[model samples]
Target: MPEPIPSFAALGSHPLHPMLIHFPVAALLGLVASDLGYVLSGDPFWARAGLWLAGVGAFGGWLASGLGLIDLIAVRRIRCLMTAWCHAVLAMMMLSLASLNWLQRYLAAEPILPWGLYLSLLTALLILLTAWLGSRLVYEHAVGVEAKE
Candidate 1:
């Protein structure tokens, strides 16, 4: 009569996964801006945050995507299944790259700035595509047509 407990990876991929996702997104973006400021305005704080934010965001994004995939697989509907699959496919790549970039940032510190920027830019593009389709699933299909509901 009781429901089975969900896995951590599944929990990471939930619809509301974005809620937990924003932190790293903002942090990463802010980091980019911070570095840009350092380059243009000579203020180092922004640049420092950029380095710090990348690692933090990488962790958050990694966690959120992990849980999200779990929920996506549990869905029985095809549309949601496919859309979630697409998101998972792209996100997996971004997460891996971002994680690597973050690790590189940690090791090389300021000198590795470009790595984080490039990774974030790529991840941002993928997230934009995934987000657009995901919005369609939620708005048109109503909770993603992939669900049994």
Candidate 2:
């Protein structure tokens, strides 16, 4: 069976997942820093900044996930399909945390409490782990590289 056009397309020579993933990873990590700033300084500015970061991270994550899904679906014969699935699940979990964190702040008017801080920290860790898995797909499994003739 043939893969769909969107699944196989790339931006220039690079796959979209690699290109689009950095934004959400960076934004999610930034959200953790902003959470710390708000907690230590008790400034609403940091809280507001965290809110914005969460929203941006969620948006970027959605975009990246779309690309990742396409790639995952297209490459059915890859060696590290399990790792890719794990990465996808963890990425979605982290994105969900970011979205929920933002919703708590924006919609429910919740403060940057200890629980929220802990969740942000956890999300940061998940991003790191998920990134490692993604790297494994490239470095260990060679999922996206063109095969040498």
Candidate 3:
């Protein structure tokens, strides 16, 4: 078996990128739910909730991505993995969509309509794809996994 790749962007032995990713993933996925809630119930509360979720998701995703990028750049073994590249690309796409979604809601007086909902849905889908690729890196390639003695 190949040797494990350690995370350069780590707090001691814990990878910062993986640790920080969960909040943004949850927030982005929750944004879709909020959008659907608004669509079904026509509630302004859901729209407002979606606004916060999008903002948090986009911002938090960037922060986590930065750490991941650091590891990708610093670790030659990680850079050699196709799964890491795909995960990075998909994550960038998802973050872009999330930023646009948040911007739409922030600028428009009445948000969470056809465009906001659509963007939310698209971003959510990308999140799933990106997450899958990331999981493959960890579980299959053992990126960031420490070797046992």
Best lDDT among the predictions, by candidate number: 3
State every prediction's TM-score relative to the real structure: 0.72, 0.87, 0.97
RMSD of each: 5.9, 4.1, 0.9
* 1 versus 2: better TM-score goes to: 2
lDDT of 3 at 108: 97
TM-score of 2: 0.87
Candidate 2 per-residue C-alpha lDDT over 97-144 given as tens digits, one digit per residue, 9 for 90 to 100: 877877777775655786568778888988888899988777777766
Clashes of 2: 0
TM-score, predicted candidate 3 vs. hidden true structure: 0.97
List where candidate 2 sits over 4 angstroms from the true fold: 1-9, 147-149
Q: How much is 60 displaced in model 2, in angstroms? A: 0.6
Candidate 3 lDDT by residue in tens digits, 16-123: 999999999999999989999999999989998999999999999999999999999999999999899999999999999999999999999878888998998999
Tens digits of per-residue lDDT for model 1, 71-135: 56664552234655676777777677767767776677563356656766776676677667656
Which candidate ranks first by TM-score, i.e. highest? 3
lDDT of 2 at 83: 86
Cα lDDT, all candidates: 0.62, 0.78, 0.93
